[model samples]
Target: MADLQDDPDTALIAVGGLDDPGPSPDKAPKTRPESGAQTLEQARELLAAHPIADGYSGVAQALRESVLYDLEAGEGLLETDIPRLRDGGVGAQFWSLHVPLELTGDRAVAASLEQLDLVRSLVESWPEGLRLALGADDLADARNCGRIACVLGPVAGPALGDSLGTLRAYYALGVRSVTIAGTRWTQRTGLTPFGHQVVREMNRLGMLVDLSGCTPETMRRTLVVTNAPAVISHHPTPVPDDVLRQLRANGGVCMVACTESSIREAADRLDHVRTTAGPQSTALTGAYDTGTPHAPGLGDVSCFPRLISELLTRGWSEPDIAALTWSNVARVLRDADFVARATKSRRPPSVARLLPPLDA
Candidate 1:
């Protein structure tokens, strides 16, 4: 299978989940009080104070253009106004059927199905330049057609209803990738002491495993156990931390996005990665975290372009940059039949070729 080469200039930086409204001025305060009630009230006050833009603005649009980006399902759609996010510069996207664990139960599966229907409805409404992407073929088709292809994924594994059967079912429904958790731990395997089984099943099923939002320990454990190469989709390394060692150790890769604040840290991490992994490891720009506690700025996405250019100036090869930005991710996508054909091939018929072109 031909690997998607990493190209920082055209890399797909994974953004918010199905409900994220992009980088909003309405993001809750970075700091919260110890008291739960006070924190809730403070968030409310912030929400009241600065209403985030509902769709794309020039700043957001410019930011979207800066990074070849993809919106993960949890942030929801960018609404019709942010066509720039879908087409202007940002390329492919992934829609998530992300349901928080609290939302599951006897009614949970039904609710998720309903959410999936809503996603379909939204995709159906997209203009010709935007498309719902399923796998590599779909993404390639979109790029060929000059449209942004959208894939399906999730932010939390427990959102799968704690069932490998459900995971398989979602894969059949077009969910090609799944992240273990966000900041908090969950029942999803590879995320906590409780996640081992889930991790095992995800590998066996060939669904792409994302470890972006997991804690360091959980991430390390997931790396130790997973047989498939994974993606650290978003999130940067703490300065001097060698994330590449963790990734390359397991045949995995990292997409390190740089925001204004995170750029220094990203550079620091890259330097450390070079020091630890040598000058020839893979790395790329991630989301635009410009040091704000909450990550939602349009300028955030553009920050990495210059950082990456600077790296090239410092003797990094284009192929190396490409591996970090695109090929590494392409490797993960290849695991899904959409990007590259499956090796084992015979899955229950329902799981066969789950990713179909939305516009088809």
Candidate 2:
């Protein structure tokens, strides 16, 4: 493990969540604020306004397949948010079962379960618009059926305690991914010996190991050990060059987050990295920091259309944009799901501990 403090360039970006008051009762407006009513008409009139060779339909199709898999959105999303997600062209969303860094042991596990229950309840309430997706196939089915596939993921590994059994239990409970570290570095530093074991177990269990919150050194090391491709659910500040290189080699995806600071910082850096790493190694996410005054009105799922437009303006080809918006993350999800199914029967029960008894 490298000493992160010794390198100023490796410093992580500060990320804090506001107390989400949950979604409002009001329905989302029919049109986006950025584009206005005229822009809405333009989208509807795409075929009439543009020549078929202009590729307007291609961009429109890409948006329809776009999946906001890593929302990091907790219990704040109300029933009304469902329609907003659909309107945003989000085919699927992984609502993060984020356990606070302050939680540990049994409390962490309990909190995670509660978050899961909340998401399930929300999906149940809106059966027409939302479906609980357990795997990549479910997501595809939901998209084909014109429904949003909602999935669950834990934001930190501590939610599993130190028990491999607890980890398997999460998988059984429909948690397809686990962020190895939370937002705080203390929870999972680069040198933490246990982090390596966690990655290996996650690989064996066919769970996605998310390195979004991990320190650069930790992310790099985990990438080296993980057989399955990992996802950086949210991009960190001062992006690590080596991690980008490893991600491309390992066939993982780095999701560029949608926070004011994240977007500003990632703009120049991501462009440079993509030139060498290839677009397949990168994806975009709406890590919507709800309830935060710092980033007012920027957390909406609707921001994705604007992002797509921006990518087009930046000279990103249709295929590259599609890969960033849909296929790359889709591939990772499918791969993880396949591994989980293959390893399910071999998974040991909680009592079949990974470590010997402390007393022994």
Candidate 3:
């Protein structure tokens, strides 16, 4: 609840969802136009009229390093999805290596590795249009070269097993960010002693701590402990005022999701709810059962343009929108990368001390 009224600069605008990479146009299911088609059409018109300038090449140099966070495109993403991102002016995206919370221990680690392999393979397949970005400088380089930069992020703390060594190994394998507590609150409560240790380790490794699926307590505590800026990659709006202020103070970001559910909530057409059952249940049910018309899913990257238009309609200035979309998050990435490079010789903390006691 950073005041959007008196402090226009602090309004946390909800951006679009993680890229979904839906079926290719040829394979897409046929359907009638939906309710927001007109709005979407208008948005496209605006984008065409005011295309997002290519960083350095366009009017907005600050936007050159723009990134799309929390993209859960997983293994289903295809060669076809690349063009959609390029056309939307997205220079970089953080592809989520999301292992389901149900798959713990070795299974979780294996699933995560497989997902990472898939993302690397996909980038290799489209080398001309895509490149694997390990740090912020890589993202900027990709933008300069006109390629879509892809970064790796693992969702949930369990994916690292009980070892901080495994976490460092993940960084060695190319993961730059981590969702500390996934959609469920299982591993360690954010306020707990063990959770603070995890946050500290993540900071030492230069890994971005994503709070997208964390509980309120977890988010608040993580903010207090994290040395680098955290991100609520895809969250609902009308976020509590206190949380907003805290996020700003920590220099974190809450990327407003552009999915049907998040859009409805931001528009005051739906109510927000906390899900206890995890991602599958939340995906099946949504923020609220308001029966609101479904907006286009993440597969259609066109949603970015529509979101931009929507923000403009609400009187958001160009600079504010640019900062939310690119500048702020880019700053976090840059700082994290600098730390990762500087701490090349630092040893990771012991796994025994990092994990909490079974009974505790």
Give all TM-scores, in the order shown: 0.59, 0.71, 0.67
Best by lDDT: 2
lDDT of 3 by residue, 1-360 (tens): 111121212333222222221222122112322345654665455444333321111101111122232122322222124556655656666666765568987898888887777667667866888788877678767777877777777445778775667888998888877777652223345455555656667767778877765777677667666655566654433345466556655555555444454443433221121111111111111111111233554334434665555544544343443443454456666665554444434545545345445775
Candidate 3: 10-residue stretch with minimal lDDT: 55-64
lDDT of each: 0.46, 0.55, 0.51
How many residue pairs collide in each prediction? 29, 1, 6
TM-score: model 3 vs. ground truth: 0.67
Ranking by lDDT: 2, 3, 1
Candidate 1, residue 18: Cα displacement in angstroms equals 31
In candidate 2, residue 286 scores what lDDT? 63
lDDT of 1: 0.46
Model 2 CA RMSD to the hidden true structure, in angstroms: 12.4
Q: How does model 3 fare in lDDT? A: 0.51
The regions of model 2 sitting more than 4 angstroms off are 1-80, 182-194, 261-270, 289-299, 340-360
Better of 1 and 3 by lDDT: 3
